[model samples]
Target: EGTVYRQIPDLIFEADYKDRWIELQEAADPWKCTLPGELQEQMKPFQRLLFLKQIKEEKLITMLINFIQESLGQVFTEPPLFNLNEAFQDSTCTTPLIFVLSAGADPM
Candidate 1:
């Protein structure tokens, strides 16, 4: 049998930090209206905080879909134009639109 062991993150080993993380998790609502200080600091390097700060639960799905579509149209795809009239020409068809992206190009 092959077994693998991994070192745990230092945060989990510290009693105070572990307790604080648990407390934060318990207190946070479903949408995470407020994030813990440590997590906020970690996200800063990746600019995740900047993006997350403006998020609203109600519009999150629409915003994500729009972001993906916009990124595909602007960055990943060539000839960035989507003809809505052409796409919906057949009202009876229920075929979903799928994108065939090039290698290393992810709209998300």
Candidate 2:
């Protein structure tokens, strides 16, 4: 039989990294939050569990674009209007607004 395993990620991204997930995990209070007292006393095993995570769209977009803009200033800065309008894209630009992440399964 195949065994169940938990795959924990080293780094996770979110709109507010330190503020959200960490705070929520702390508040979970697994010690205080429990099954029935009797159920907790008994040892049980052999159940399968899975947690698949996907990106939060807006947050991920904001995070990545912030990174890009910081790295490369004026992404589409094409100067000189010497009949080269085709090669030159508008200097004006907007920060990246769309981000996509794919979620997948892992076997253990």
Leading candidate by TM-score: 1
Task: Spell out the clash pairs found in candidate 1.
Answer: none
Clash pairs, candidate 2, are none
Q: Candidate 1: lDDT over CA atoms?
A: 0.45
Please, what are the lDDT tens digits per residue for candidate 2 over residues 34-89?
32222223423211111111223324333344434444544633354544353345
Tens-place lDDT digits, model 1, residues 1-108: 111112124544666566655654453231343333354434432233234334344545544444445445435433568776776774444676666899999777
TM-score of each: 0.26, 0.20
Q: For model 2, where is the 10-residue window of minimal lDDT?
A: 45-54
What range of 10 consecutive residues in model 1 has the weakest lDDT sum?
1-10
> How high a TM-score does candidate 2 get?
0.20
